[model samples]
Target chain A: MDATPQMTCQTAREAFPEFLDFRTAPTARMAERSHLAVCPDCQREFATLTRIATALDEAPSALPSGRMRQRFYAMLEEEKHSARSIHLAAEREHHARGLSLWRRLGLPLAGCALLAAGFVGGTRFSARSPESQDHSDPEARRQLADLQQRVNAMGQLVGYSLIQQRHSPTVDRLQGVLTSASRENPPPQVINELISALALDPSAHVRLSALDGLAAHLEQEVVRAGVLACLAREENPLVQVSMIDLLATARDASARPAIEKLSTNVTTDRNVRDAARRALAQL
Target chain B: MLAVRDGELNALGELFERHHGRLYGFLLKLTGDRSTAEDLTQTVFQRMLKYRHTYRDQGNFAAWMYHLARRCTADHVRRSSAAPRPIDPADLNLHADDAPHAAGQASVHDDHRLLYAALALLDRDDREVLLLSRFQELSFAEIAGILECSVGAAKVRAHRALRELRDAFFRLQRPTPPVS
Candidate 1:
């Protein structure tokens, strides 16, 4: 009796596809080869299948034009450039926050301490003679103005710190920040912080607050540019609608092209398309 | 690829250089239009960058790439208003132009043309399995992963597609019967 199992013609024909695989086991390949030697039909079918496989392997691959490579590299360069800019901006914002902390809290606290000491001394001196305490003194007016300025600085610092707090739940912190920022004549640092939040914050609600906080400052070129950039990358429909509305409200003609593209984009949300059309009309 | 996932953006350029030709070939076979293949090739790489973080260290990059390529092709098909253009046999460049002229050369060229025409006649899924298995030289396991099927199923599909292609080739080769 033969030690190896003999492959039948049907089996050999079925195994022809597996034989096309270079990885087929040698034992199985030998069995199929033995069958093919004796079986003319299997041989013919196997030969045709082998030829087909070879032709597939030898099929000439089409090469993409040079423009494809150029376009890919260009896109990669744009991504790298945008990533670098975001990284640099985050770093600058980090440094600015550190400096602003000292300037807002450190300097104001120091001035407050000095004013307290001066006030205690003045009180002690006036206690020594009530008649010498003059309300009309220019020195007293100067100290009052200085105290008021420091107190205002301290208030702005507290508001900015609330906006920067990462520990608080995003919604709560953003709400606090927005409330503080909505005050009349918010400081420039507050506006900058709001713009940073609008651009970098992950939460849509937080971004909306930041956008609202920035509403009063949209006249500033930096704020308008920041909002426009946010619109370009903004994916969330609600955020996109809000951004389009804000841009249109500002009458920013520069955003017309982006808005027009959004209006015509078939992939954009239906509501967003409608909003974009309305905004385009306004623009 | 791990480096690309870890923010080394330039590492992707190396990957692109290495795989772009084969990737373009696969897309060309799938799309049958050079310009569409070129556009989809760029789209696949763009998606690789966009979805790099999803790449697993243990996963095959080629398989992942074909996964993306399949998606890009599908998206392109879905977005386009027209059906895919059938592949022209001439575009395959299968003729042995450089070979010394011989009696068998013309028959070989005709066979090549018939084979490509048969390939174009196959169902899209059959053509894709054939392309991935034979043209790309991917293993059954890799094809299984890309096609989201079992390895056995991938092998079966490839075999069936090959048989159909062979039948079509012979059908094209047969002389027309005289009209009664």
Candidate 2:
């Protein structure tokens, strides 16, 4: 006699779902199987349930359109871009606050230092020996001029150091620097800094401001080269459009080939492509 | 998903690629409208990105995703002016592209049609349980997590739903008596 108890039809039917599952224990499945073999009613019910499960399992999943993938990637890109922009904006705000504190305190301290330097220098020159102080002594006059130049250089160094301390300068700071640097016949070093920012700043706002700062110097070879290189690598459509417009405004015909390539590239943003085409025509 | 939560958002694309097909299918069966299903599928992923910080590392990603999918479906139903109704058989799109090519091909196709119609006729809760259990192939514990029920309850619900589906399928399979 079998040691295992026989499963009643009610018990076997109740466990049909488990019985159909391959994960069910062999002994339990065998008990259900023995019941089904003896009871035709349960057998038919089990067969019908089995068929239903198979039909559902074999059902083909509908294929979504290719447009869905395109939409998904576009959304992901937008999210990533927004996340980066938010992070950069926060950094910019922090840097701006730090600079505001510096302006509140550092400017007055710098002014005081300049006045102290002038007072000390004047007192020392007056206290010098009569021969050295003689107004007709050419060597003495040259020394005084050297002293004045050194004091001026020291003031400029203080300002430059303050600007250099910020690792990630905000748009406001960059704009302020560019504004001060935009003097008549701006220094060569200033021009180089502006060009570098235009070429590499991650923020489009900063790059656009840098481009504007370089506008007056577009006639220079280095400035033109930097803008052209920026055009080649720019991925943001807004920045690309602005750079194209700047090149067009400058009438830099040498940029025609790069603009032409951008106009023809399929992956370029539509607005950027249109702007590039317009720039090429202008060139 | 942890990668997503930790700000390596690109990891989400990998998750989407791995699961979107089954998810879309699950929604398609749930809504019975392709366009609605597609829209809801997109919404589900968007919610995942939005609420990724809420996901626990030890939890199953599929369960988390289906939980979101269920909320999206519910929201969609509430937004519509009309109450939910049985899906039209035509909208079910029960084409059996994978059915084996043999002398029984027609019979298999007929069976698919009948099963889908029965699925369409099932109550919303019943249909959901069947889709989660049989189609998505999710374990009962995971279904419980998504449905906010106990594992035993999930199993009981699935068994009841399957029985109803079987009865509906056979009812449809029986030929009608000719009018006198």
What TM-score, to 2 decimals, does candidate 1 have? 0.64
Over 4 Å off in model 1, which ranges? A1-14, A28-41, A123-283, B81-83, B89-105
lDDT of 1 by residue, B1-180 (tens): 999899899999999999998999888877778889889899999998888889998778998999899888888877894445656555553325534257876666677667777887888788889888885457788999999999888988998888888888889889889999
Query: Candidate 2 at residue A258, lDDT?
Result: 93
- Name the 10 consecutive residues with the lowest summed lDDT in model 2 chain A: A157-166
For model 2, residues A169-268, the per-residue Cα lDDT tens digits are: 5744464445534554655766766766777666677677778878888889888888999888888899889889989988998899999999999999
Deviation in Å, model 2, residue A193 alpha carbon: 37
Docking class of 2: acceptable
Candidate 1 per-residue lDDT, tens place, A64-145, comes to: 7788899999989988898789999999988987876675457657766876787688678766875555657777667667
RMSD in order of candidates: 10.2, 14.4
Report iRMS values in order: 3.2, 3.0
Cα displacement (angstroms), candidate 1, residue A235, comes to 20
Q: What TM-scores do the predictions have?
A: 0.64, 0.58
